[model samples]
Target: MNIRKKVIFSFVILVAFIISISSLSMITTYHMKENSSFAKQVSRLINIQEDMNELINLVTIENSLEKLKNIKEKFISFENDFELLREDITKKDHKDLIDYILPNIRQNQNISKSLNNLFENEHAIELIFDDIYKFQNKHIYHNDLFSKIYPEENEKRKLLQELIFKTTNLKLIQEFGNLRYYSKETLYQHRDMETFQKWTNSIDEIILELRKNDRLKILPLFTGYKETVEIMGNLAINIHNIEKEEKILTTKLIKILKENRDESSSIEIKIEEVAEQFLSKISFIELILVITIILITIALTLYISSKLTSIIQKLNSGVKRLKDGDYSSTIVIKEDKEFSEIATTFNNMAQNIEEHQNTLEEKIKLRTNELQGALVNIQKQKDILENLSNKLAKYLSPQLFESIFSGKQDVQIESKRKYLTVFFSDIKGFTDITDSVETETLTEILNEYLDIMSTVAIKHGGTIDKYIGDSIMVFFGDPLSNGKAQDAISCMNMAIQMKEEMSKLRIKWQKDGISKPFHIRMGINSGYCTVGNFGSKNRLDYTIIGGVVNLASRLESNARPDQILISSETYTLIKDTIKCTKKEELQIKGIAHPIQTYEVISSGNNSTIIEEQTGFNLILDLNQIDKNNIINILKNTIIDVEKNI
Candidate 1:
């Protein structure tokens, strides 16, 4: 278990132990008090039974009313005490004792009162006879004195009669609920009442006989006194009979008292034993509580502390491992309390972190591999594109190619009017020469001728637009431009170089055994023309088109072999840097009027010259050809030309 649960469980165990101890102690103590009270009551009841009996016996023997009066008070008090105690008793242990004893105490509560009644009867009988005895013993016998003293005796006897009536009446009420009266009718056939009737009849006969003996003057005072003495005697006998009946019942009462006493003693002993056992048990329980508390405290403390320390250490270790980047670390907990929950959460968190890290690492590795593959593929594609671009450069002008690839020009159907110098050149009678030669020889010668012309065109900063068969068109201006006049001059210079290169080719072709030589015609024009990509979206040609371009083609078509033609507009632009001669105003189809034209002769500074005679041409570039071989080559060229003719 975790620390919190261990502590709480320990506390609960301690509390339960404590409560058990307290509950047991309280129960034992309660029983002990009950048993203690029971024992005391048993002893007290025995004492009351003994003391009240002895006091009643003593009062009966003394026969003194004062003493009996005191005894009566005690009897009432003790009897009331017994009654209350009997009512208060609820224990089953003394059930027989209380049952036997309590009834006896109630039944005999009148014992002292019975004795007092006996004494009162005796006193009444004595008073009844006292006046007769005094009257008989009278010393002065004078008639007046005798009358006076005897009358006083009669008065005394009358008072004694009243005492008898009151005692007998009280006895009657005690026995039969108030039946005594001044009548001859007997309400009961009781023995004492019968004896009282007998005495009453005997005294009445003596009193009647004494009336004959009137000489007994005291007899006159004996009126109603006989009945008084008889009633007093009967009361005494009744009291004695009641005492005898009480005495007669006492043997059984004494036996019951003895049995009850034995029963009480047994109960008291049981109470004492129970109280002692409870007391000893309470002590034992206290000892057990202390020892159990100590054991539990030690056990729980060790268990909780060990568990707490170990779990904390494990948690701390986990934290340390995680902090050090050991994401694979985990913990094992067997307890299923709060700490187990925490450990589960922590384990889940750690597992998630580890899984996340693993997943992230795997993703990074996969992406890295993909990127490497992509780079390799991209490099391969780049190599293919570069090769394609190199091959494509041969078809497009370098200026247009560079501009488009360099992001300087947008490849779209767009054009602008730029004043450009345009040039067109073609072989003279190229079809007739082709029909005379073999196809392979013609092909080699045409390629050789076009290669020479293209080299000259590029070297002069002209963009080679396209070539149709043996014809070539070139232009200067955008995508790059110097000036309109400079463009025109550059074109003229390029044409002149072409003528010189042709002269050299003619000599080389003759040496290769060609029976015919090729001559080229060139045309130049300068004007505004639309120049840009011209075609559909999928395919485009970076070239020029307009009247200027058409005019250049026209000029080339009209020129003679080995001749250069120039429009007036182009001649004006190149006049300062080139040598041209006016030819004629040739009528062009698309023009409203005829246009002026010229023949290009040479550069303002001529670097070379090539001349045509009747059957041969002479070519020389003193600045280009080796000085030592020039004369021999010229004399050799003259012989070869004449031989060919």
Candidate 2:
């Protein structure tokens, strides 16, 4: 019986020991899970808090009172979440856990209160902005009404003064006063009070001005209205402060509740002690059983850990190789059936990765080649364009090229030299011809004439300097070698050619049933002159300069169709090559001295001179000449020219 009782007691003790070990293991696992859950919750709360803070900062930077109000509503919602978290903590069975979490909850509550206060302050400022807007409207209406009564009252002045007063007062009393008393004390302490004092002085000056204005008798009413508005602004700010303070108090209360909910240390300690007492009750029976169980458990644990560690080490090595861009590496563990399957999956994944990596590398290489080709083509195109621009520069005179390339709209060339020869030629009766011609035909005709003249000028070593409407300005030398005498002779020869060419052109026109006469005038002069690039830095032009150039133009103005006139110097130079007739010395406009002029009588070739009183004839008195005789002379001259041709 004694042996049987001892055996039964041993059996009971073994059962109790087994129960204790199992309970301890379960408890440890539960504690670990609980802690992990709490940590994740805290992390989530922190992220939410950070997001809220960023939103608040955005609203503050914008100074957007409307957005601030919206954010305030969101803050209220966040506060509710804080309240719920606090309540959740309070309801938790584990008080020890609550203690660990209370501080974070309390911090979140404080942040919410701070944001609420910021919103209230911004709202108060918005009220002041509203007052400024109303004042502006009032000033606008006042100015409009006043201007109608006094027509020249300078109502704008009054409006400006009122605007200054209102803005200064609002900035001082509303913006500076409230923000200074609060924001400055907290954030920026160095702001000067002198600014506010100056604002008040400015308001007094505005009042003095208003009193001086006899037409504005309602100054007292205006003053009273302004005072009331200021009072209202102050009252609004005060109420906002009170509300903010109330929110802060409420937040503090919530923080206290969170603290109460988080008192878990004592409970955790008691639980541990209870577990220890229960464990001690089975200590004697558990000693031998625990030794044997521990030996077996250790051996099983080491064996399993070794297997797991081997597989884990292989996976870690594979991951490292992947990080190093070795997609060919793979994990392989054959210790157990489960691990073998995992290894197989890992090897398959490595193969896929290797294939994908190769494809990606090939695609990258192709894309790089394409980009390189495009870059080469773009560079080649840029080079070609640069070459074209340089070639175009050769056709332009230096002054024109500088104006175009240097980004100027116009070019001017000025010269200090006293003497220059100038030539001006125009298609005679161009306006009358164009009146019956189509616009396209007219443009074509003008382009043809310009092309011919340009070719003639270039052939004679002359510069086709400029075109003014239907006229041409030609010079002997510019941006190249000087050929003044040679250019004059060549130009005379070109004029003779032009007259011959025009006769044929006229015949063609008549055959085509056109009735407009095509005649041209040629003028030449040589004297001291100036020339160079001239005008503002923004615009410049290259042309001959001086009184000599002007006189040449005057001589051109005096010439008639099919006629070429020259100054005395030009006549002397060309007398050996061409025939000429001396004309009487005549006084030209804007000239202090009279100039001797002559006509090119002939080209010493087949060219004939048509005498029709060519050039401005100052010798004949218009008042004394008979109109019928003049008409008869003109008719006879045309018949004579036709016969000569």
Candidate 3:
């Protein structure tokens, strides 16, 4: 059981035992007092009965009128006393006293009945008076009234003499008269010493006789008185015994009380002792509990402190490593649940930091590589720009491309002196070719032809200024500073070479079963011209602007395929280096006057030329020649060209 329950249970049992013992002790004490009071009352009633018996015996013996009066007076007093005693006994209300008094009253009534019987019977009265005289004389002594009778006592005797003289019948008087005289004499003597002695003896005889006749008659009163007295004595003894017993009981009670009190005191002391012991035990338990709690708290604190210190140390180490730029530290604390999670999180954070650090390095490397690649690309673009500048200078002039590309805060353009050769080429019957070809095929062919023509121009120290449909405007002698005359001759030679290359390519295509023929027309002009970048600020072009440039374009437009038409000035400069044929004076568009043109016949030591008529010329002459005649001429020309090669 728990301590509290145990204590409560013990306290309840102790209280129950005490109450049970106290109740039993109280009941025993009540019974003892009741029984003791009963015995005492019985004893007192018996003693009263004994006194009535003795007084009744004295009254019976003395029967003289005088003595009777005295006895009567005494009896009256005795009756009064008896009445008082009876009242006293009745008032007592004790069972033993009532028992003793009730029979005595009956006995006294019997005595009164005996006295009345004496008065009623003449012989009985005479016998009773005679017996009383003898009983008194035997038992009484000293002085007697009747024994010492004399002449002086005659007057007292005269009343008795007169009673004798007054007798009526002799025969009746014979049994009574002499007896009356003797009765009077005895009565007279009963007053004397001897007579009284004789009367006392005579009363004793009567009493003895009465006792002899019905012993139990007196016994009822005597026995009742005796029994009452004995009972009273027994009661007294019992009361005394009770008192002794009460004394003993009181002593025992006192002893018991003392014992109980001592026991109670002991119990109280024991209770106090037990309480003290319990308190001590409780205090010890509390101390133990406090100590245990303190220890547990201390242990918990130490454990937490150790864990916190360890965690903090690890965190500090991690922080130090992180400060030193090492993002690879891991926390491995295995403490409490929360701390474990924190450690795990710390490890995860470290891992994340390390991963991020690696990712940052990779990103930095990638960004650096991208920047380097961009720089390399920019450098390549710069090189390309430089090359483009050089090419543009060749066509327009160095000053022109520079002015266009340079980011000068302020820019001004002035004409510079330079000898330049400008060339312009156009495809013959290009409109017809475009109309016959698909748009995609036409663009493809145009880009291919332009790419080839531009390559040829550039190869010969020429620059392509622009492309105008199936035409190209080329220039020389500026970016690459060769002799203008030589540049013109070189341009002319490239144009002729281009025509011959195309014719051979066409022949190869014909042999390979291609039906379409490709062709180009070119015009070259050499002159003194202004070359630079020229335009508004936002827009510009690097080109030659002069009459010679326009005249060169017009000549190229009028030339036939496989023809290199040069201006008169260009022919004058390159006539010695390249072969040319005088072509025609052509009225050109956007020109105020006609200009002399020539066909570049051949390059040095390779005097080969395709047909002078372009595809446009052939188409124009289509109505003049039959299809069969044209086919026959083409076949014959192919045979002749093959034999010469």
TM-score of each: 0.45, 0.34, 0.33
On lDDT, the candidate that comes out on top is: 1
**Model 2 segments more than 4 A misplaced:** 1-419, 604-645
Tens digits of per-residue lDDT for model 3 on 49-92?
33333443453444344664465455445445544544543454
Clashes of 1: 0
Clashing residue pairs, backbone N/CA/C < 3 A, model 1: none
Output the better candidate (1/3) by lDDT.
1
Candidate 1's displacement at residue 209, Å, is 99
Tens digits of per-residue lDDT, candidate 2, 604-643, equal 5432323222231122334467879977987998899799
What is each predicted model's overall lDDT from 0 to 1? 0.69, 0.57, 0.54
Better candidate number, 1 or 3, judged by TM-score? 1
Which residues of candidate 1, in runs, are more than 4 Å off? 1-324, 328-351, 612-618, 624-645
Model 3 off-target regions past 4 Å?
A: 1-414, 505-516, 584-594, 607-645
Q: Which candidate tops TM-score? A: 1
